[model samples]
Target chain A: MLDSEVPQEGNSTLAGHKKAVYARGGDGKMHLVQSAGWEVEEIVTRQAVDDLLRMTEDARRRVEAGQTSALEYHMHRVRMDIPLLAQASGIWQWRIRRHFRPAVFARLSPRLLGRYAEAMGLTVDQLQKTE
Target chain B: MMAFQHSQASHCESGVMASMLRHHGLPLSEPMTFGLASALSFAYLPIVKINGLPLVGYRMPPKFIIKGLQKPLGLKMRFETFRQPAAGVARLNELLDAGQVVGLQTSVFWLPYLPADLRFHFNAHNVLAFGRDRASGDYLLSDPVAETPVSCAPADLQRARFAKGVLAPKGLLYYPVGKPQTPDWQKVLPAAIKKTTRIMLDAPLPIIGVRGIRRLAKAIERLDAKNDAARTKLFIGQVVRMQEEIGTGGGGFRFIYASFLQEAAELLARPALNELAEQLIDIGDEWREFALLTARQIRDRDPLAPAALADKLRLIAEREHGFFHALRRAA
Candidate 1:
């Protein structure tokens, strides 16, 4: 990686930000060069992010279609799965899976809802109702 | 808090480790810290899933450098993880107030100061939380991957420190405690080089070292056989994201290791090390080429492009195998 070869293609994964990268300078030493971004990096980042967004959108549709509950949508929206949500909230995976059912989720106590909300970095109200 | 310099680095854990050690009066470059820790390696783990995608890491898992340096450098450090979040926060503040710079393992997603595009659920991101901002009273962080030192609100910092999942940080904070005993450079450098060669070439696991790259290459070809364009695209995207998107200093830390080798070449006056460094830079370029080809394959939707991509990786793997073998002999 030469300093001259530092990718400044401007379509980096970091959006507009630049970060330190080591590149060979004219002095034949490694210099900390800030990069504008790379197209290859941008595409991969967008792919991963878009996949998550797609999952969230798919969850939204499933919830609307009554195939799953709002809990499923919110979980994907917050970038978590069953095991992650369980670990974060200290709820069992089985119990969380059970709560994915609309009827069980509807009857949840406020305290339990608060735990899920806190684990996902959402307010309890936000957890209950989706926009 | 103000005692340490905030320097941006291509990678986080090694960068933060270097910063902390430098603040403690040990002068080590980020690349040097990384190489000494033997932190560079490739692992394509299918069993560990992130959002239904296999875990593809450019280097070893996080905190390897921070923990790896302790024994080799004769450094004594205090590491603490709290079951309670408040205790964790309190301990961090106490360390800061004691005029110590602390290294933290945090989740990238909860750190609000980062650009929205860079935030994800990946835990084990490392940063140095030095002290508080004068005006805003936020936790002043020297995030190695960020160009400038940034400030995080207390709430955000707390959330980040304790963010939960696989590799959940659990409010882990660490800092140097006692003065370090320096080791003999002649012995340490060569030993580090040998350890790296062994890891890259001798690790017995099928999913590690040179074998790991080959495993991933074969998996990519197998994935292409499914002829599911979306699935293949996502899997390849995961590889690119791990290699290029994550702060790998380009080519998944290959360039960084090259820099380290270059420095080692000069420090030890080992011309063979210099030769190896050049060889590595070429491999790093090959890795960049791999990324470029994969991107084009995604765009063209050419069915066989992925197998071609896999072929590129296998070539790189064989080159690496040879490189490490030569390195072992050089040491």
Candidate 2:
């Protein structure tokens, strides 16, 4: 959990780190603080502080760029998250086949890799090696 | 008080159960009541039957082929394929607009292929035309992948797709028209003789060695360094791979696939797999079974939760390395 009251220190929604952010108040529980737009980190983490921090970074980056809305920034974050997602999906595929052997690998097609990549926030390049 | 472990034992037990249920064309949704009965009867015996000359190596379609098709059935007589989640959904919408039924084939890709240390594909496949809300255009789907008929709407569809691209919805648009009818028993078996072994005859069986492992490992390490979302991403990767491995072809693959699907369905029902995994560990086995079965309560409103997915994937990955090591030793 992150502490929002720690102060933004003038980090507008348009600058600095652009991950997601989540916060927890003095009540000892977590809460979402300033969920401006969908940041890469926000979509990944459930904690409010994490979401807040990520969102703050995203907002600050967009704000500095003089962008109109957070949605555009979020879409951009979506692109960056793709490779990570793909890698994650790869890990998941590994778990599914934990008990099997090359037969599964032989059975897996390229299309499945692409879908798996999308789910895990990865790109085809990451999911499938080029060379 | 006791804790339920998602250990290898649970996975194995679940795998064996899945194989038997599938063999009987039974839905894995059977409760512990039946499971306990079977256990007491010691009726869970393995039956091996010899067939024609064993077909050679495994065969898969090209990535282009898998990704090119709008749905899994779209790959009729073709090798495996995949598509971008949004694009896959868009294609699904297109197929549904055309009025067709679909079939989804999902799997865990990694467990079986760990020896090669290469990338694997694992995910669920949902086939059926989209049933949409005429007003909001929210779509609906029916997946023939499970023991029982499974259906979901657009929002849920997107969530599942988001959770892992493993879920492939191949349109068998003509289901309403005429899909050759098979016997009831045939439909229930895991290795549906006709369908499971229908790989292209001329397809090459290449042994994928450790060509990609170094790179995959590096990428995982980088993701781990970020340490924020990497674990989640990596976890999902492992799970997806595991699914693909099971969905592929292996002696024990069907059982493995069944266990994960049961777990995935269970997770899909609860807030998420990790949450349930964490809570189940302290709740003991009986309560855990209830918790697992409660996963069937997945509602249309709940979207596929990726964060929770990542959490579950992480748990799966933590224990997965051992299995991979075992595979390596066997190989």
lDDT of each: 0.86, 0.29
Best by DockQ: 1
Backbone clash count, each prediction separately: 0, 124
- Report candidate 1's fraction of native contacts: 0.70
Error (Å) of candidate 2 at residue B200 is 17
Lowest lDDT block of 10, candidate 1 chain A = A11-20
Which segments of candidate 1 are over 4 A away from where they belong?
B224-226, B301-304
Evaluate residue A66 in candidate 2 and report its C-alpha lDDT on the 0 to 100 scale: 48
The 10 consecutive residues of candidate 1 chain B with the worst lDDT sum are B297-306
Evaluated on CA atoms against the true complex, candidate 1 attains a DockQ of: 0.71
How does model 1 score by TM-score?
Answer: 0.96
Cα lDDT for residue B143, candidate 1 = 95
Which stretches of model 2 miss by more than 4 angstroms?
Answer: A1-56, A59-74, A77-131, B1-100, B103-127, B130-138, B142-178, B181-331
